[model samples]
Target chain A: MELSLFDVVGPVMIGPSSSHTAGAARLARVARQIAGDFVRVSFGLHGSFAKTGWGHGTDRALVAGALGLTERDERLRDSFEMAKAAGLEYDFYTADLDVPHENAVKMTFFSADGGRLDVVGASLGGGRIVITRIGEYPAEVTADAPTLVIVQKDRKGMVSQVSQILAAHDINIGVMRLSRTARGEVACCVIETDGELPDGVLGEVRSVPGVLSARSVSV
Target chain B: MYSCFADVERLCAERGIEPVQLFVENEMRLTGRTEREVYDRMDARLTIMEDAANRALSGPLGSVGGLIDGLAQAQWRYAQGARTLCGAFLNRVMARALSCSEVNASMGRICAAPTAGSCGILPAVLLTMQEQYALPRRSVLDALLTASGFGAVVMKNATVAGAEGGCQAECGVAGAMAAAAAVQLRGGSLAQMLSAFSLVLVNCMGLVCDPVAGLVQVPCAQRNASQAVGALLAADMALSGQLFPIPADQVVEAMARVGRQLPIELKETAQGGIAATRRGREIAREILHRERA
Candidate 1:
């Protein structure tokens, strides 16, 4: 993905966290893409990022941005102050994940309608970003691209069956990442493929047995 | 159809230009922006980064708790020197690279290519070579053009985003570009430039994008220092006639493969590596707690 100065460079941001402090918040907001309105968010920060997260304003940034704010949004700094005003109910926690990154954040957001999303994000520096998890999928999706994220049941021949279908249409999947959900019954595949998603692929994927829902993201 | 260094060299010789210069000219054509424009954007951004660093460092602190202070202070000093030498009006890329180092910083705001994370590597290597060799500005410009060409090739075939690939994509690619540019500066033919480009990529492929706490401090700052040094080394080797077992194109393809295989946590998610460690986690908590307090 191509990053502009506004994309990688910061200052129109809240303090403390760019990846977790600010980006964690942005990831929550983007999580709304799958979860929809009326959401409950649980934020988990890994060890070091967690310790300094508050001072970095990550909690506020995540909450505020979750309530709907952009990195360039002026209100990002005051997101915490505005959370009460916005009536956002949220919880923050710390965890020791056996991951190598020093600034990782995971947010699991549930919509009122039973729709939910799990987003793992990292701030890669210069305000650059990467979304590493969605639901239970282990893939890297850019919040800056047009992406297709599919959540489905894990079954034999699933990938091949889907790959054959995509290849038939001459669509090249740039980067395909799959992670089994917590339940292990389902798997989420995040595809950062080149070109636009064909209009009806979501419906087609949804029709597949064990396929829960397929969503397309353009940010 | 054309795959080897010889093919690229032959093309460059036929075109009456060095191999690296061909890359630069091609980059200019593809971006649809002039060399001056790219330079200007990079220059401008450097100024902004320097000013921000200064603002961040205004007050004296307790003991240096984390990495931000050291990197920001270094960037501040580097920026001041860059502004003095390159003038405030240089290109953003040039300015940013110079500002990150003392001798070459520019005088203004500019655009940062690939990213602002390792902005200093490219210009620091290229400009220093220019001064050291006493080459004309045009020669240096050709080298930059060549580097841009290689950079665009990577952008097309693989990835440059630290988020997608890793710091390898950022500093690594910068080093590759600089190596090719340096080859041109040394008057190496196109084949030599390609050798340099390939050599750099082979060594840097698969390097991770693990920025600590996502601050652009820790690894990003220190990484820039190493990246600049690496680019110079790669260029020097290429100039001296080192050969790579792998092709440049193949190395780029390997980088893409590595980026794909990279765990999401390693590819800039900050979920893994140093970003997720006990110390990294503590620093994050401390920052958050301080904010809340």
Candidate 2:
């Protein structure tokens, strides 16, 4: 590797833990976009993050962020109180997992209109976050644009059918991951196709009898 | 914004931007404080750390903790000694009063790339390098600019949440950012800077976000201490003419991948690692129960 002075010291930021607090705020904000308003949030902490969520203020930061707060927002402490003040409810819990990450959080957010989303996200060091799960499905998709998360039945040709529609529009799938429930009765296909999913594509896919629900994420 | 270390150097050559000028502007943007304020904060924080180390050293403690205390004292003294060469390194102590004390008191501040509890690592390293290298403050400023850009990329690319990616994203990234700056300070080329970053990322990858008792006071401080050493070592590797096999992009991507594989408990939930303990959890419950009562 070629050496440069910039590589040694790059940026300045807040501290204690960047990935846990900053990334959690961003994750909660993203979750808010999908979860919508008038919802409840329940956060489950794993490993070290779980043990010190309150002390590290990870839980408060997440809740504040879910309510639309940024890392620099002075109201974050109040943001937690504001949730209840705004009639928003939330809870916190802890779970154990045999994993390498010492910092992990599983957040379940509920929307008022019967929309429920569960996001399992991890804060890698350096204030970075990855959303690994949405609900029971493997929604570990990238935040890149033109992505579609389709909750559909576990049936043959379903993926190809969706691909065909996307292909017809000249849309390319950058990354795709599919997972099914343990019972195998339901499955989800999350396609991070490039350049928008096309307006009618989502409606048409939803129209499919086997398709349960579909959502789009813009990077 | 800084795709490669070359970009930073190129900008310097093309725009005649000195490192100190760039450093000042970038410092203001990143910390919401002026260059003078940052200088003051740096001095104050280093002083505080030194005092803490001296106090800890005066007493008989475990070898590891004692060694850290002594090292910390030395780092502060080093910064203090270089104050003349790095005149900007000294400042009023009050400038660094914790901005998010509530978060730290009740929960804890997320010091983007620093230990939320310590919240002074990046600045500490930056100021120290400026003083130690006796480089033009302008050059240091430019390095700071490049570093902020790198930080933004990390914030966009991976994550900064310990709960999500663990302390790796926090202090790990901070160290990497600092390593990049250090390489630049040593007048290493772009390739060297990126190599330094690769070394920093690979070494600190997947560091968990377990804060004992949820307080940023304990392991958080220790983590910052280690992070400083890591940053220096990574920079030294690149400055010493050693090369990293992996590219910066690949290293960052691998970090993201590793973060994904880590269980939620380890990320920052305080559930799995240091957070989950017969004593730690009991303390948490007791605190919460006390709050309720």
Candidate 3:
């Protein structure tokens, strides 16, 4: 809880609402990372995000975020037209996530190659967001700092191997969570770091044995 | 986890400096940023706040909901030639507060000083204080740093989210934050800053978050303007040796408790207060339908 002054005073952003707009955009950005390239995406709104999201521009903000725009980007208001021009199709619907968080959304991203990614996140107000679930891998990623998400075979020592590589780069791991659907099947390791893993760290993590994909995203 | 007002006081005492120094050190230590980096970022935010206010004052009528369109500029017109009520300085405060609030409603870029709903309060107070006192930008940024410390404390001990703690948490905290910032800019002591903080909370406690139709228009804009004035007045009280009977920390605790006790209808649910009125319901429906179309 070492809150920065920026947390209390800033995040210079465009908004009708921070939770509904800026937080929505951050959630979408994280989801897009897990989602890969997509042609169509359906946003499953939950709780308050569905009820009053329209007025807050949650839909447009999410689209703009998925298109890879930062929260402060001036293009956020014109996101709908930009999405259409980019040939990206999207829809919004109320979804029953059965989660208690008042502001949540689940996204289903469908790539042209038939690959699909499902991500669930909650907008925790004041432009803060957390990616709660990514394709059945329960994890927490706030994107407050450099975050590395590694999908790999849930073999023993995978965590240590990833940690060793990061340690090699002198990047301190702030918080890490490992979630697997089954024993030795598949796992997602969400490593939140203090300093960013220097360039080429993602490629190194991807090349590690048993690792499927690795991606780094930051706010 | 330097979370509360006590932490700030401790840091200031340990370092033998003021809240401004504490702000810079805390931010640097918290984010691993350099001193220059920290000031540059704060300076950028101040620029945005000023820019938002300027745009709203000079741009065309731009509120998305048309509720607060041209409000800041309109006040400027009203301030001219005998329509002046509270003198030019106070009028400027209200106008500037509306300017930033209207900027927010129109989807213009602005710094969320704690949150967007209460964004106008600090800028209005600090900018107006600068205009009156002839303070430079550096002094204003210092005040902003001081205000951020106050905000960080309230955020830690209580809540700043309207949905969680009502408008008392949002506007109330903003006023308190602005009061302390105003005191800092005017060179008030730490004790005086604390007194001003308590004054704001004691005065504006238990305010409901009943934004009409759940939009940050209507009372939200009005509250920003009023809260700015309230903060400045509180600063004056602290400067004049007026003190709050209760301490600032206790006032924050009471504010949080009162917010929790408020009915859900009054807490941005849009099901009560002004949001529950017939016109409020109609406005909600109209906004929803218009967006759908």
Chain A TM-score of model 1 comes to 0.71
| TM-score of model 2 vs. true structure | 0.53
Model 1: per-residue Cα lDDT over A10-53, one tens digit each: 22343333444445656666665655565477778876558555
Q: What is the TM-score of chain A, computed separately for every candidate?
A: 0.71, 0.75, 0.94
Docking class of 2: incorrect
Candidate 3 accuracy as TM-score: 0.94
Q: What's the true lDDT of residue B133 in model 3?
A: 90
DockQ of each: 0.05, 0.10, 0.63
Model 3, span A1-219: residue lDDT tens: 366888888888877899998899889988897667789999999999998888777888999999999888878989999999999999998898966588999999999998888999998888989888888788898998888999999888999999999999999998999888856499999989987678899988999999998988876
- Best candidate, DockQ: 3
Q: What's the lDDT for all of these models? A: 0.60, 0.61, 0.86
Per-candidate interface C-alpha RMSD?
8.9, 9.1, 1.9
Query: If candidate 2 were superposed on the true structure by all CA atoms, what would the RMSD be?
Result: 11.1
| Candidate order, lDDT descending | 3, 2, 1
Better of 1 and 3 by TM-score: 3
From the highest TM-score down, the ranking of the candidates is: 3, 2, 1
